[model samples]
Structure formats: structure tokens, C-alpha cells
Target: MILTGDIGKVKTLLALFSQEKEAKEVARREFYNKEYASLQEIISVFLKKNESPLKEEPIFIVCFGIAGPNINGNCQIYEPDKLDWQFTIRELRELLTANYVEVLNDMPALGYAIPKLAESDLVSFNPNVSAEKGNRAVSLATGTGLGELLLYRDRSGDFLPSPSEGGHANFAPRDNWGLEFLTHLYSQFSPPISWEKVISWSGLQSIYGYLKDRKGVKETDAVKNRLNREIPHEVILDMANQNDELCQQSLKCFASLYGAGVGDLALRTLAVNGVYIGGGMVQDILKKEITKHLFIEAFMNAFKDKEGFDKTKNFSKRNAAIPVKAFINQEMVLMGALQRARIMANLD
Candidate 1:
């Protein structure tokens, strides 16, 4: 069994897999944690619900890919984003009675899925460029928060992934608008603006706030109501799709900020293999037609990865040469956990 999802959402996703003769899913379920007293409760219900047909195959492992960093089998989550209670690996082992239990940071979990990603699973930002093998990086922006990490191949050619606290690193502004946004955030939240402040869910909302409150951009009352009641970024994207100027500008700002951050990751990690953009929010971003162009162009312009003294031509060439893609499949983390579980159980 494997579980993966944002902890802040109080959601549980479980997948049962068999790797004996073939690697495949035997069963799967997704449920809100709020519906049950604990994960143990829903997992018991899930097992009973799917018991009969697959009773012949018994589960031997359970792995979790957590949104926060994991150290010594315990998740070091942000205090404010605590789960109802942290589930210990030992407790999970007892509940499932599995032979092995594993925990992984979400960013690394996302990285582990890169090798298995098919072209169909991606929407390329810089198409027609082949990625050269080296290190790779993943930058994820979810409703929960922002995460970044690195993946490098071992001697055996399997990826060895690591967690990162890079999202909390200071935000680097790109232009006047970026500086203005930084000042706006500083005025509100005070000092040390991080990339998480400009590129994640709250980041998206921050952009909208900058436009509506500071730039004096207009927003309809309906949009305002929707923003309060519905998911903020989703509402913004929907409004942008409907040609709302304020919403459109917010999306554009988000794309550019995201580009700058991804550019930083690619440069810092020297991720010649490629840079992957993933998270729960990707679907919303891709729904608007212009978002891809906005993101791609911004990423290229921000791709100050490397340049020779020749400057202009070299800068353009360097920017255009890097490979970037946004993955829309929401199952990568779960699949990654499954992959890790398989590795733990010696199935691969």
C-alpha cells in the first residue's frame, strides 16, 4: 500500500499494488480524513470494502510520501499545518501489519516518478529540446505550499532523491513589478519575502491582493464573493478565462514569478536532465490558454542559467536550450510512493 497527498488537506489516498508477476494496482481509494477519526479507521474500512476478491494476495509493505520533510522516519511538518495527529511509522506498521514501512519527503517522492513519466503525462514548456542526463530538480506549488528538491542517479542508475528547504529561501525580484510586489508583501507580512510567498496558493492570493488593493485594479463583486467562498486561485483562473482583467494580470504575475523560481532551481541544481513543474495547482494554470505562453516566455527570459561575455545572443541561446515541462498528472506522488514501496519490498 502507498499513500500520498498534502497533509494540510486532511485527505488520505491509498493504493494497493502487486509486483509479483506484474506491477499493477489491485485497489485504490481516496477519502477525507475529516470523515473518520483517524487514518487507521478509514484504512480498515477500505480493506474490508475491498477484501474478498483479492484476499489471496496479502499486503507486505506500506509507504508514505509526505508534504513535509522526513527525518528518521518522522515527518518534520510545519507547526501551523499539523495533521489531526502525526501517525508514527511504527503505528502504521502495526495497523497494516506490513513487513516494512517507509516515509519520504513529498518533493523526493515527486522526483522518483520522473523516470516513469511518459510524454503524454507532460505539457512541455520548451518543446523540441532533448534533456541531457545529469541532475534533475522538481519544483512543486500546491495548495499546501511550495517545495523544491533534487534527484541524481546513483551508480546503479536509480535516482537518489533528497528533500529541500529551498522554498523558504529569500525571494529574488526580477523587475519593477516584482519589487513592488515585494514591497507590498513586506508592508503586509514584514521582511524576508520567500518564493513560497509569490508562487504557491497563498502566493497566488497575494498577487491578486497586490492587484486589487495596491494597483487599484477592479474586481467584480461576484468575483470577490467567489474568491471568499471558492478556492482562491481556482476562482481567479475561472475569472481570467472569462476575460477578467484583474484575474488575468494575477495569473501572469504568478507565471512570471514561478518562472523566476524554476530558473533559480535549474541554475542552482545544474539540472541538465530537466526541470519538472508539478503540483495540485498545475491543472488550474493550464486551463487558461495564455498561461502556457506567459509561463514559457517568462521562464526563458528568467533563464539566466549561464551566459558568456557575448551576452545577448549567448543569453538567448542559453535560455532557449534548457528543457522545462509542467506535469499535469495528479497521481505522480502516489505512483512515486508505490515505486518506493516496490523498491523497499525488493520488487525492483
Candidate 2:
């Protein structure tokens, strides 16, 4: 069993290896984090649902790709502000009786999954910019929370993946509107607000609320009722698809800021090999929102934004070499967890 956990939901994928030893899916289920008391319960449900398979086949390994708190320490999912559930490794080992059990931060799991990704799994908005052999790469995912992973080329020419909590890095403002947004966040949430505040599902909603309440962008009562009744991001995307002006405005803001934030990461990491976008939510917008081009433009502008480089063609040329690609697979995180699990069990 391979599981991936985030702030909003958890996904479990039951996989078996093919004749070539590649992991193939057997079953899958998604659980809302709020509905379950802990990760143990979620795993128990998956196990119970597949009683027949385990009875004959047996689960040899169990791995979890989770965000938040350290896997080696408390075995918890994120902090209290996020999933807030905790389970020790010992308990899981006992529950599964698997030969190997591994749990890690989702970023590293994503890192493990990158090199294995095929051409079909990757897409870029700018067709002219293709991935190249560079010294570094970075993966940034925006879901219920923001996630980042860094891949550095070693002396042997292989890219090594490493986990980073860079999403928790401080939010930087680029303009007057951004400065005002920062001030708004400071007023409500505690200090040391991170980029996750401006780049995730809740982040987009925060942007929408800011526009409606402070900037006075119009919002109708019908839209308000739908937002209250349904998922905010889903409703926001639905309204944007229907050409709701305020929803479109908020989406533009979210996409632009998300692009800008990624630009900062590209510069900071010098990720010339590739800048991979990995979350399903971000990809959903890239597929659904009409203003995806705005995201590309904002990304390029911020990526090339450098002091004394406004007139330098060399700066733009060097920055332009950074390839930005989005990973569209919804089960990428699960695939990643399976990859690690296979390695742990010596099945790959």
C-alpha cells in the first residue's frame, strides 16, 4: 500500500509489480483528512477494503508520502495547522507486518519520482524552452499547502534529490498590491507568513477575499451562496469558467503570484535543468483557467527581474534557459511513494 497525505486529503494506492518489475495499480481510494481520526484509521480502511487481495497476495511493504512534521521524529502529518494526525512507525510495522515500511516527506517522494517520469507526464507552457542538462532542478507543488524539492547534479552527472521546507519561506512582495496583501495577511494571521499563504488553494481564496472585501471587486449573492455551500477553490474555478468577473480577477491574481513565487525559486536554486510544477490543483487551473498565458508571462517577468539586468541581454538569455514544466499526473505523489517502497523492499 502506498499513501500520500496533504492538508486537505489523503490518497491510497494499492500497487503490484508487473513482469518487468514496474509498479502497477490494483486499487485506489481518497479520504478527506477531517473524516479520519488518524493515519492508522485510514490505512485500516484500505486494508479492510482489500481483504481478499491481502489474504492471498499479502502486503509486503507499506510506505507513506506525507507532508509536515519530520517522519523520523513524531511520525505526524504536518503541524497542528494542517493535518494534525500522528502515528508512530512501530504501530504501522505491526499493523502491516510488512517486510519494509518507510514514511517520508512528500517532497522527497516527489523527488524520487522525477527522473522516472516519462515525456507524456511532463508539459511546458513555453514549447520553445525544453529541459537541458543543468546543475540543478526544483519541484514546486501547490495543493492544500505548498511543497518544494531540490535536485542537484553530482560529480557523477546524476541528479540527486533532496527535500526542502522552502514553502515555509517568508513571502516577498513585488508591488504595491502585493505589499497591501502582505499587510492584510499580517493583520489576520500570525507573523512569519510564508509563500504557502499566497500560492495554495486557500491562498487563492485569500486573494479572492482580499479583492472582494478590500479592493471592492463585485461578488453576487448567488456566488456567495455557492462558495458557502461548496468547495471554495472548485466553486472559484467553476465561476471563472462561467466568466464571473470577480472570480476571473482573483484567478489572475493567484496565477500571477504563483508564477512570481516560482520565479523566485528558480533564481534562488539556479534550477536550469527544469522547474517542475507538481500539484494537481495548480495543474487544474492551468487546464481550466483561460488566463494561463498570464501565468507564463508573470513567471517570465519575475524570473528575469534582476537588479542591473534590465538592459542586459545576457541576463535574460541565462534566465531563459531555465525550463518550466508542469507534471500533470494526478497520481504522481502515489507513484512516487510506490517507487520508494519498492526500493526499500528490494523489489525494483
Best by TM-score: 1
lDDT top scorer: 1
Q: Candidate 1: give its CA RMSD in angstroms.
A: 3.0
Model 2, TM vs. native: 0.81
Which sections of candidate 1 miss by over 4 Å? 1-8, 53-55, 75-83, 216-230, 304-308, 311-316
lDDT score, candidate 1: 0.75
**Could you tell me which 10 consecutive residues in candidate 1 have the lowest summed lDDT?**
1-10
- The Cα error of candidate 2 at residue 313, in Å, is 8.8
Please provide, for model 1 over 54-170, each residue's C-alpha lDDT reduced to its tens digit, 9 standing for 90 to 100.
467767777767655555655543435445445677777787777787777767777778778898999887788888878888888887568888988899988778778898899
Candidate 1 backbone clash number: 0
| Candidate 2 C-alpha lDDT tens digits along 122-154 | 777566876677645554656667888788876
